[model samples]
Target: MLCGCVGLVWLYEGDVEVAVYLIWLALVFDFLDGFVARLLRVHSPMGKELDSLADLITFGVLPSFILYKMLQQQEVDAWVPYLAFLVAVFSAIRLAKFNIDENQQTVFIGLPTPANAIFISSLIFVDGSYPSLLSYPVLLIITILFSYLLVSPMELFALKFKDFGWKGNEVRFSFILFSALSLLFFLHLALPMIVMMYILLSFFVKIISTT
Candidate 1:
């Protein structure tokens, strides 16, 4: 919650990069919350619901706020900011879907909110060296696309390792290795690219598996 508060403040102050960094920290804490819960063998339905609430703030609202500010700066339209809120709305739906989804115990049926948040937050880099990426048209398309992805029924892979074997896990291993290479070579730009790669690779693997 503290991280969420700081992210809100930094975003309001127009320090978008710092706001994004805070979100990354929040993600770390988010992961640790589940890991710690499992370690202690304490599971509550309340805790599950509370975690979703927390995610709505950090992953959903924060990234949407980032887009809202960017839209204001770009002076696209008053309605564009409202369009940004769709991200939050769809993210909430995605969380709800995840809760009820038995198939998602091992994989996701849509873009995870955290991945969507990271992809959106990583765009602040465009504000610096790649300002072209912040054009009103591009941002609008991205806003619409990501909002759809949050709720789309496309299956996505989870990062969980089911076992030590590398045979059936080849796709997972490839994803990790390529993501690492992207970070090494592309730096911050690698983030959005990695998100795109994740979606594309999942689709490709699904097609191959079915065939």
Candidate 2:
């Protein structure tokens, strides 16, 4: 979470690249916190609450701030930039839901905050490469779309692996392979695409199972 705060500082400093890097650092800490807790078998209610709070800052608010900064750069209506806060608002609800919902043990009911954060934060690169592409309208649309996705009741597969067997882990392994190749081939541009691919693949798997 402190990394997230520092990311805000960097965002204010107009060093968006640094801000994004700090977000990635926060993601590392987020993963380690859960890993360490599971390793020690020390799960507490307070720890869970703290994790949600920290996630709110690091994944929720930080990514919104990035969007806010991006929207501010565009010559949009004054109220447009405020829409970015929708991500933070929905993220709070998402985290709250996750805390109380038992069904999310192995699958997410909606988009994960960290995944959404990564997708949003990576938009900086998109905006950098194609300034016109991230115009006010486009950014606003993305914000609204993802805000709804946060609580949209759509199921997304979690990347956990209890056993690395090919039968049950086909989707996970395929996604990981595609992600690796994507990063290798597309570099930073693959970040948002990877998230999109995750969503699409989840839906594809869902359809397959139903049929």
Candidate 3:
């Protein structure tokens, strides 16, 4: 809740970097809330529902707000703002599916809400350096692509810790290692690239495992 408020302030201030960091902070809180819940053996149906609702606000609504800000700056067509709502709707669907799906106990069936949020936030975070890339047409296409990923069937996103010593976990471990290195080197600017890479890497891993 505090993180969400901070993000809202950053949004109003037009500080995309701070807003992105606040989104990341929300992600940390999201993780800790679940961790503490489990450690305290206080997990309940209401807690689960509450977490999802919090996520909807932090990840879904906040990202859309950031994207809307970006589009406003670009003087994008008035209709472009509607695409931001697509993210929120798709995120709601993703969270609802996660709640009911037995297969998502250990892994996600589609892109997670936090990832989607980070992806959108990163676009604003690096907007100046990637001016040509952040144009309305490109952003529109990306918005559509990410919305598709939110419900994409072939994606198998992981939510649990991979066993470090396990043979089959090598890809997961390597991906995490590379992601950490990317963050270390590029800070927030690397977020979107690393996330896209992770999605592609997961696809190949799934293909190999299935074979």
Query: For model 2, what is the C-alpha lDDT against the true structure?
Result: 0.92
**Steric clash pairs (candidate 3):** none
What candidate 1 gets wrong by more than 4 Å, as runs, is: none
Candidate 3 ranges beyond 4 A from true positions? none
Full-model lDDT for every candidate: 0.88, 0.92, 0.81
List where candidate 2 sits over 4 angstroms from the true fold. none
Measured over all alpha carbons after superposition, the RMSD of each candidate to the real structure, in angstroms, is: 1.4, 1.1, 1.8
- Per-candidate TM-scores read 0.94, 0.97, 0.91
Q: Count the backbone clashes (under 3 Å) in each candidate.
A: 0, 0, 0
The digit string of per-residue lDDT tens for model 2 on 108-200 reads 999999999999999989888888888788999999999999998989999888887999999999999999999999888899999999999
Candidate 3 lowest-lDDT run of ten: 155-164
Model 2 compared with the native: what TM-score? Answer: 0.97
- Indicate which candidate wins on lDDT: 2
TM-score of 1: 0.94
lDDT of 1 by residue, 36-87 (tens): 9877989988998888888989999999999888888786657777788889
- lDDT, candidate 1, residue 8? 96
Candidate 1 residue pairs in clash (backbone atoms < 3 Å): none
